[model samples]
Target: MSERTPFRWHIAVFLAPAVVIYTLVMIIPLFATLDLSLYSATETGTKFVGLENFRTLFGDAHWAEQFWNAFWNNVWFFLINMAVQNPVGIALAALLSLPRLRFAALYRSAIFVPTILSFVIVGFVWKLILSPIWGIAPSMLAAIGLRHLFEPWLGQETTALTTVALISVWQFIGIPMMLIYAALLSIPEEVIEAAEVDGITGMAQFWKIKLPLILPSIGIISILTFVGNFNAFDLIYVAQGALAGPDFSTDILGTFMYRTFFGFQLQLGDPNMGATIASVMFFIILIGVCLYLFGIQRRLRRYQF
Candidate 1:
């Protein structure tokens, strides 16, 4: 072997494919979309409108109201997932991570089955289950003398958004559960033994020791939940359609963008408006991620051991 160090072309070679693909697929498209938002389609094709498209999105009463409504709805959707999914996932993960838990693998597989399913499949399956016509929700409720409680949850203004949010939570809970479980498993056995020796057993050990150590993992899951929930589209689209129907009660930014871009029933498509909506969503996600990383994550001191 030569004494001189060889040139490190391997690193560049390995990264080239991923870098090229990302630039072409993600970066180029993102910039293109941003550029597209600046131009509005007219009779003679697209016209440069600068910030006029954005102003129309936020200033026009008709568009502004819908945009704000969708933004708020997206926030609520994200909040519900954060509240429901993470806790349930953590609880299930904690339970399964226990040393003596029976059939742990089977339970994990069963719980994770939903995550393996496509969004289209999950949405349609839930839609059928919750459908007023052929859905089993009413009958299932009736079986327990709670039939009176059933009322097309997916079709009502009061419950439509929340019901859809919960459906999303159910379908994706496996991700956090798997992540937390992995974190829990990574905890050193010696540390647990030490905790046991100090009379910290069972729930005490989990809450006082394991939880603190795994907090970084929880933070990661929380941020992921925020990002995914805010950007969600396929589930709601498949279940409620692009209009987010029943008086647009379930309308979120994703569906709103779809409706703006494609038009539905009466409304004509507006590409400039659609791009503006998309730009807004991108910023919202960016802000959320920044907050999580700089605000929440900074305070969560991760332990090496």
Candidate 2:
């Protein structure tokens, strides 16, 4: 019988620093937050309330209204990215992957540069650009004779959330594009040659062959978008403030938790309730990932070529 290799003590040594840092920053805080959710502050001190906070969040009318509003907004935010960003990304990737495409790298870099920029910067810059008073959007529209279409989009309740979501899409579309681009490039040359022999060329080739093989990549991008979008805070906060205003039309779970945990203008901070909100967000993300991993991923794997 073959003997097992000796334990790699050096491997553990190399991993120790990263493990320690992650535990300190991520793991410990996660557990602490979860623990904090079970208690509520009292005049005397604190009281263990079990799931009472969660009940208040969902059952109480005031909290329920805000919670549902934030929840629905978050859902819309994710849906926009899924519908617009990913499809556009796929299209861009298909074009960039074309063999004869010129300056593909330049196009890729330009598109991807926004993804690397700080969300705060992107949000703040867009906010300034869209300002009704002195912003360039009105001027740019007037230049093209479309000035009549201009409005205070960022300040309007009806358009504010959608505008922010599209801005997010514009900034992050490059991620799915790059990921799918890599997936496309990884397709075996032999497969392309075989498809060519079969007279499956151009869009027909992509629709049937490339698309099927890249379904797994799309699935991965979708899940990542879900997790990231659900956890999104920086951009919305930067553009709309802590209240996520225009009458809280842009508030998502992250912002909701932030306001609850940290306090806003008049709302006093309630750490226990805030922790409950955060816990709920964590579970929402968890369920989503699990659904994708166990359910959608299995189906995606079947289409892998």
Top lDDT hit = 2
lDDT of each: 0.91, 0.95
- The sequence of per-residue lDDT tens digits that candidate 1 reaches over residues 1-305 is 66887889999999999999999999998988888899998889998989888999999999999999988998899999999999999999999999988899999999999999999999889888988999498898999999998888888999999999999999999999999999999999999999999999988888999999999999999989888878888888999988888788899999999999988889898877888889888888899999988988888864645
Top candidate on TM-score is 2
**Residues 14-93, candidate 2, lDDT per residue (tens digit)?**
99999999999999999899989999999998999999999999999999999999999999999999999999999999
TM-score of each: 0.93, 0.94
Clashing pairs in 2: none
Q: Candidate 1: where are CA atoms >4 Å away? A: 1-13, 302-304
lDDT at position 239, candidate 2: 95
Q: How accurate is candidate 2 locally (lDDT)?
A: 0.95
